[model samples]
Target: MEIGLNHYLVLSTLLFAIGLIGVMRRKNLLLLFFATEILLNSVNIAFAAISHYYGDLTGQLFVFFVIAIAASEVAVGLGLLIVWHKRHGNIDLDHMSTMRG
Candidate 1:
């Protein structure tokens, strides 16, 4: 049997679920970033699948922009994480509660 849009959508949904669970359960900043990446990737998969199904390039183009934005987010986020870790020596989300308003 050939793989179809439904298969792709189901896979995307599963990945999104896993990513959501990870985001909800993880306490570390680094792990949270990974979970967010997973969520972005799942959406990318869905977009590409639909773009292919419809023979349209819009979804694929949107995926590329999303990827670029995700990359920039990772770069900025990791930079902040490094600074936070250097100053606090830990990357736990609980530690972030001490931030000043």
Candidate 2:
């Protein structure tokens, strides 16, 4: 079967759902960060599709910026996660309640 706009949309929707579920259910900081990235990427997919449909490049340009933002977010998130793990001796988010002032 040939792929079309609907197929792209369906894929984006499915990815969004998975990411939402992951964000809601996962406790690990790493997984939480990953889920956030997935959500951002799904938006990129939809924007690219809409741009293609309208013969406009603006949406695609926006997606590229989103991707750049997501990459920076992942870097910061992982760095924070590592610091949290080192301080707490574990990665369980529930145990990380205190932040020094």
Candidate 3:
């Protein structure tokens, strides 16, 4: 059987759910960033699938923008993560409560 839009949608939904769970359960900054990327990728997959089904380029174009944004986000986020890790020696959410202004 050929894969259809519904199959793509279901897959995307599952991916997004897993990412959401990770974001909620993870305490590490790096893992949170990874989860966010997974969420973004799921959206990209849905967009591409819908665009293909509808014979339109808008969704695909949106996916491109999403990828660009995700890339920039990763760059900035990782840089911040490094700085935070260097200052505190740990990137755990619970440990962050001890930070002072």
Model 1 stretches with alpha carbons more than 4 Å out: none
Pairs that clash in candidate 2: none
Per-candidate local distance difference test: 0.96, 0.87, 0.94
The TM-scores, one per candidate, come to 0.95, 0.87, 0.93
Q: Write the per-residue lDDT of candidate 1 for residues 1-101, one digit (tens) a residue.
A: 99999999999999999999999999999999999999999999999999999999999999999999999999999999999888889999998997662
Error of 1 at 43 (Å): 0.4
lDDT of 1: 0.96
TM-score of 1: 0.95
TM-score of 2: 0.87
Ten consecutive residues with minimal summed lDDT in candidate 3?
92-101
Which candidate, 1 or 2, has the higher TM-score? 1
lDDT of 3 by residue, 1-101 (tens): 99999999999999999999999999998999999999999999999999999999999999999999999999998898899888879889888776483
Better of 1 and 2 by lDDT: 1
- Which prediction has more favorable TM-score, 1 or 3? 1
Best by lDDT: 1
